[model samples]
Structures are given as C-alpha cells and as structure tokens.
Target: MGISKHSIETLKQTLDILDVIGSVVELKKSGSNYVACCPFHDEKTPSFVVSPVKGFYHCYGCGVGGDAIKFLMEYEKLSFVESVEKIAAIMNFTLEYETSYEKKPDFALLDEVMRFYQKNLLNHKPSLDYLASRCVANSSIEKFALGYCGASFETIKFLNAKGLNKTEALEYGVIGKDSVWEYARFSDRIIFPIHSPSGKVVGFGGRTMSGANAKYINSPQSKIFNKSKLLYGYYIAKDKIYKQKKIIVCEGYLDVIMLHQAGFDYAVATLGTALTKDHLPLLAKGEPKVILSYDGDKAGINAAFKAAKILAASGKDGGVVIFANGMDPADMVANKQINELSDMFANPVPFVDFILQHIAKNYDLNNPLQKEKALAESTQFLHTLSPVLQEEYKPTLAHLLSLPIHLIGSKRLPQHNPLTFTTPTQEIAESVLIKTLLEKPEWIDFALEYIDISLFVYKRAEFTKLVANEHQDSALIALMINERIRPINDLPSLKEHLRLFITQAYTQILSQIPHYTGMNLQEKSILMKEIKTKILQLKKGELLPYVSSSTF
Candidate 1:
C-alpha cells in the first residue's frame, strides 16, 4: 500500500525544511535565508539558495527550483515515499497506520550509537594500536567514520538511554539480549558504519581487533538498510565518483579505506554480498565506469561472473580488475606495492573481456567444437544489449570469435528514428497555421470562424479543451502538462517538433470547424467529404485521384 496523502502532508509540516538539508550541506546564514554549494551540479561559487520562510530552494546555476520534498528527491536520489519517511524520522513523528510495508525506525537511535562508537575509537588504546598495526592511519579512520564497539553491555545502555528498547536495539543487530540480559554484538573490533546514501547510519561492519574467528561481523538487515543496496564508502565517495566518472569496486572495508588513503577517491565496496542491480544506478551516476576488484579466488571469480551479467544487462560500461599473483587491493596497499594496484586500476579489462577469459580458461579453445560453443555463449551475451549498442559491438564480437562480421544479422533492432517525421504535406501546412496561433492566440478566434475542427487527428482533446475554455494563450502550457506527451527534455528535438506539431494540429482543427452562416447543408456535406478524404490521404500516404467516380 502507498503512504496516505494525509501522512505525507503531516510529515511535510513536522519536518523543518532547513533542518533536513542542513544535515548534509553546511548551510550558512544569509539574511533570513541559507546558501550552500549546489550538490546537483559543480560550481566554484555557491548558486544554491534556500529560503526557510518560503520553504523552497533555487539553483541559479542549474535552474533547478523546487520545494523541500523536491530537494530531498534530487539530492538523496529517493522517491517521494522514501523522502517522506526520511523526513518523518528527523522530526520523531510516528507514521501510525500499520500496513504490510516495512516499518523503518527513527534514525535518531542509530545516530546516537554512531557517535558513541566514534568517541570510543578516540579514547580506546587497544583499538588504536590494532588500527596502527593494520596500517589504518588516524586521518583515514576519522575520514571513513571508523570506530570501535567495546566488548560489553555499555553500548546497550547508551542506546537504551536514546529511547531504544532491548527489542529495538536487537532489531538493528547492534546488540543481543537473552532473558533480560544484553551484550554488545561487536566486541573489541574496528567499526565501520554502513550509512545510507543520504548519510543516515544504517548498520555496522566490525573487524575483529583480537585477530579472532569470523574476521568480519555485519549488522543484520533492518527496516532502513538492505545489505544489497548499501555500498561501503558511498556516503563519502559519491561526489568524487560523479566528478571522476569512474568508481573502483573493491572487496572489503579495509580495501576501500586503503585505496582512499592511496589517493584513489572514487572507490566503494559491497557489504559482504555479490554485486546486485541495486548497485548499478548508484555507481552509474555521471556515467561513471565501474571496475570490479574482487579478490583472486574461485569464489571471487564466480562473484565477478555474476557481476558481469548484471553490469551488461544494465547497459553500463564496466570491467573487472584481477589482482596479479592472487593479491587483494588491501594487501597490495599495505605491502608498499600501491603503485602496482594503481596500474591495475589504470588499465582495467572490460567485463566482456574478463568473461571471455574465464570461458577460454575452462574450455579447449583449439578444438573447433569448443570454439563454436564459446562463440554461441558470447553471442547470446551480446544479444542482450540495446540495438544501438549491439550494432556498435557486433564487429568486436565477430573479431573475438574469428568469424566474418557480416554473418551476424541485425534484425532485432527497433525501427523508430526519433530524428525524422513522417507527416504529409497538407499536415505540415496545417501545422504552420497552428504554430502562428500558438505564437499569437488572438489569431485563434479569427481562424476558428473560417476553419473546421475535424481536420486534426492527434491533439483533439487539447485543442477542444482550450477552445471551450477560451484559453488559447495557454495551449502550449496545457500540452506541456499532459502526461501522455513525453517531457520536452527527454526528447532531443522536442522543442522544434512540438512547435511544428502543435501549430499544424491547431491550424487543421481550426480549418475544420465549418462557417455555417452562408453555406447550404448539401454544399457543407460535399466540403466535409473532401476534407475527410484529404485527411485520410495524408494519414495513409496515398495520392488523391484526379477526379471522383461521380465526376467521371
């Protein structure tokens, strides 16, 4: 079920617009308003202005102007419902109506827990020593929001004070309780807080400080956090990834931290799960290329293959980076071979190449039978791409398979050419008249007196609505607001095409409405038949006969 409109409005009212934005961006006081660097676009000077009084923000640079809800939608990249729920958490307002929808908790408790962990990291000596041994620098720890969860029930008490009950705490997987006894789930471990893209602390990944069993422990799935959707270091590296147009997908938290420390800013890691579609758009922002840097193991290769299928299906350019001599990025960085790691990132192989390599390793490529099988498998992979992309890559696949390129047929492509129009000559003439009306609405009434309404095929509703309302001035705006029509920005030539189409449709419709003051019924019927035949000929691309059968 969807969130009720009443609940959405209530959330809008309870959550202060300024407070929500201020958390992510460092908004400064400017008269009664606030201003910050626009997160949506890059600029040296601040063009993003927020007016708390008006409850709206306008970016002069990008020309994006909207309310708080719109701001959250654009900035966090969330849907309407997600934005409402996020705001609801900030205001401590309960969204009461129970439904099958997952119940997300207030982030206040998680925020408190993160702060506690951060403080513990600063104060604890053993945690500091452990990090030092692992070559995790002090600066890196603070930058990545790393901390330590003490091995005791003190974390439980800290969370309890923030109004989180035992059940609620356990639900987050931060603590465990058995018969009124509670203990920390993560003990003597270097903590990495898994945050949502919006920067809400969702869960934790703890590496054992004692070098004990289970090298890593992660927070169980909670309402707000899905392991598949959450990427480690995304909160920090998102902007860099956008700017660089590339992202390095490493295997572990330490791998991410090490890479970041080594001056590679655009890197993130999965939360102990294989790559999923949830990671695609997040990584694909600004058209960034992805490089999967999974460890060199049988399990890692298997994971990479799975990731390749997803990336290929998503229609994004990505590649796999196999470490030399079975070394992970973290090991390479720690062992002072950071340059080698950087080289691997610099010259990444395409995901398709990696998949083919994997196939060649298992199959006997010299055997004609094996080569044929390999080509068949690769062809199926290539066929999954869009027609445009398929055409571009077909030659490359032919080369890889050692086959003549022309042998691959291209019949699967769609036939629509968005660049061209197929309207008839009379339709173009009518369109020109409509354009004149759009440019000057006063002419609409003058044309309506002489023109009939039946000549237009499409845009009948829009024309009729405007004529009935005597709102010729708003004809363009009416069409723009219609859901049936695609957004002007989405179509490349929409502006030019819309002007032409609307003008013609308007003229044709206006020319169709009969002027009945002088015309007899029989004469009007003959004129109507001629106009209908003209429309049919125009639509079907058929030539009108020189004379009618009656005339012959």
Candidate 2:
C-alpha cells in the first residue's frame, strides 16, 4: 500500500514552512516576515524572505520563490515523492492506501542478516578462525559489521520465509536464484551494509573470505540503490564529517573501517563507481575539502588525479595522499607503524606537493627536454584552476620547474562568472510580483485593476486566477499549493527575465492608479500618453524618472 493524497496534505498542514526552513537556515524577524541569507546560493546580504501570511518564500538575489514543498525539493535535492514521504514522517501522519502489489521486503530482514553475521563472528568456528589469522580484532569485526555465512544456506532460507522471494533477494544481491540456491552473493565473505542518509539499508558490499579471483562484490542497482551517488559509511560519519569540515576518501570498505577504528570517523569511499557530481555535493555538505587516500598503484594515482580535477572544477579543495611504500590504507593500518600513519595525517601535505612529488618520481628534470615536457604538463594542469588559485600556484610551479615565472603567466585564461546566464522574462516577472505582494499586499487590488491578465503566459495564468478570486487571504493561500509548473523548467532563462519585467510592471501599475483618480478626460489622455512613453523608454533600457505635477 502507498501513501494517500489526503494524508500527504494533512501532513503538510501540520508542518509550518518557517519551522522547517529555520532548522537549516538562521532566521531573524523583520516586521511581519523573516529574512535570511539564501541557502541555495552564495550571498553576503539577506535576500531570502519568508512570509507567514502568504506561507511562501522568495529570494530577491537568485529569484527562487515558492512554497514549502518546493523549498524541500531544492534544499535536500530530493525527488518529489521522497520529499513528501520525509515531511509526512516528520509530521507523524499515517498514510491510507490499498494496493494489490506484493509486499516489499522489510528492513528487519536486513537487520537480521547483519545480526546473523555478528553471531557467526562470535560462534562460527571457520569465521572466528579466519579473523584470528588475519589479526582482525573482535572489536573491529563488530565495528565493521564483519560476519560469516555458514557452509549451509540458512540465511537465504531465513530471508525467503520473511516474504522476500528468490528473485527479490537476488535483486538485493543477498542470494542467487540458481536451482542450487548457491548462497547467491556472499558465499563466505565479510558483509558491509550501505545505508542511505536517513539510515535505511539500501544495499551491501562484500569482501571475499579467501584469496579469491574477485576481491569485492557490491549490490546491483535496486529501487532504492544508486552506486554513483552513495559513499560507504556516510550515514554514520556525516556528523563527524560536518563538524571536522574535512573528509578522507579511500578505496575500499576495510580502508574506511580501519580509518574509523583509528579515530578518523570522517572517512568515506565510493561504492564501485568513480567520484561523480552527486558525490561532490554530499561531500560539500560537510566541508569543501576532500583528501584522496587512493592506493599507490598506477590505477589508484590516476583515479586520484581525475578526482582532484573534478573537485577543483567545482571550487573544492582536494589532493592525493600517496602511501609511503605502495601500500593501501588497510594494509598500512594492519602492518605499518601506527605512529607513522598518524603523523602522515597530522602533517597533511598540500595537493600541489603531492602532484609535484609524484611527477618528480617519474621525470628527470636534469634533462632539458624532460624538464620542458614536465613544465608544459604541470603548467596546463595549473592553468585549469580559477584565476585566484592560478595566481597563487604560479610562483610555486615556476620555482619547481626552474622556469621564468612569466612563462606560465604568459598563457591567458578564461574567467568564469556564474551570473552570466540570464533568467527568462516570465520567471523574473513571477518572482518579482510574488516578492512585491508579500512585501506590500495593499497594491494587490491596484495591480488586479490595471494589469492585463492576458499579458501573462502559462504560470502567469495561475497567478491571475488567484488574483481574480476577490479574497485577500484565500488568494494568498493559493500561492502555497504545490503543482508542476511546466514550460518554466524547460525555459528557466525566460522565467527569470519574466520575473523582473512583471515586478517592474506591477510597481508601475500600482503607482499610476492613484494619480489617475483626480484627472479630467484631457488630463487622463495626457497621463496615458506619458505612461506609454515611459513604457517605451523602459523597453529601450532607460530608467523611469519620477513624475511631479501633471502637465495637463
């Protein structure tokens, strides 16, 4: 059964927009509305305005204005259904729906699987013996959710009995569907459950028990699982990551587990996929810095370099952490001096240093031709950085390559401005009008009388309908309802431009209305001419001048 629409609405009614937003953004009272720095963009001034009267928000700086659901969708980067489910849970609302679909696998089954693995570590002889030989501690086993599956397939049978069919369990990569039921996935491996940010078991990754062909196997994509967007151990480490404002990104599950065991709780790793844009934002939530602790192998170094380029492009600080003697983090934790590992983290090297150090190991700068090649490659990489960062690195690269400082500086780079993209006229108008109404509702009646509703396009039609309702609070309330505003998303630039034009038109219409009341027929005609002239001038990029005494 799925949630009902009525229940969803009821949940929304219980949760206030101001309270939800206040949880994330700092808000201060300003007359009847509240103001804060817009969370969706980088800004120094307080441009985000919230109005309890209208039950909506608008950001003058970025032109993002909408109701609570819209806010949740944007703020959390969630799908519409996901946002509704989250808000429904927060409001303690029970959904009512009936469906003929088969019952979905319960989360308790995953819990039981984890419990079985834990019990196996303590009671199962083969599992216990395997951990002892590897020098893996009982405490570490428990911490990493390390467990063993028996020689038999009891775990599979147990899950099957709990409403999970062979196909569904196999979909989650828990068991195989072959007639033998060959313990589908983890035959005898250490299991690691991947959890969503909200703490639901979405998938798993398992390490082989023996020195086998495949080292690791992860769950395939399921309804709730996506490999690119997920990082192993993020749910548990998010708070620490947020507090420390730094995250240690490693290659494998054991590497992350060992780091946590070593008191570096802010470590995370990709789930069988390369670091992506989805991964970048989640890391950005904690801090704008990432340390790539990849293996010392050529593949690992190449992955780290690629990740560094992406992080740098997104305006994040990132670098590679090469192991001292071609060791992975897990091996280092188990075999190397713990103090040596600790010292490396404590005295973290800059990304540039790591890049130069690695290059030095491979290139012979004593040869003039080799030196020139190194300079060109390193200079190209440095050039990709922002102007400010490029300037900072110029002197360092010059000294390292033993080249004239101006050599690198001679290459011109393109400057990036985020605001170069303009918004559509419709969106600009809608946002502008919404902001104006929230600020001064008295102009609503004037706007309704003078502005031609037909002038507005699709989204503008909804706004016009709300205005024509002839009820003050009711019209404002309509703005709080969430619906897909099509064509707006398709043409975002036009939306932004529309908001500006609409806001200016609303202001002009409101101001001109009061002056027209005292004018005779001749005076009214002159006023109309003046208004037309002003509109034409405005279209030509001229500012509106103040009107004093009427010439007529």
Best by lDDT: 1
Tell me the TM-score of model 2.
0.63
Q: Put down candidate 1 lDDT per residue, 1-552, tens digits, no spaces.
A: 777777777776666667667656655445556666788898655667766755667665676766677778888899987887777765556664546565655576777788899999998898888778768887999898888888676786787677766676678888877796778989778789998876778889998877879999899888767888679999899889888888998889988998898888788999999988766546644568888998878888889888987887665687898775678887777788877877788888787667756755666777889877877777677676667766776676666667688865443644432113566665444444454454456656755643445545554554665566543223333332222223323222333443344345434543754764566778767766765665565455433322321231
Question: For candidate 2, what is the lDDT?
Answer: 0.65
Best by TM-score: 1
The segments of candidate 2 whose C-alpha lies over 4 angstroms from its true place after superposition are 1-3, 9-109, 129-139, 161-163, 178-182, 272-274, 326-328, 331-339, 356-362, 409-552
Q: Could you estimate the TM-score for every candidate?
A: 0.65, 0.63
Once model 1 is optimally superposed onto the true structure by TM-score, how far is the C-alpha of residue 181 displaced, in angstroms? 3.1
lDDT of 2 by residue, 180-222 (tens): 5457477676677887765667777877777568878887887
Q: How far does residue 417 in candidate 2 sit from its true spot (Å)? A: 4.4
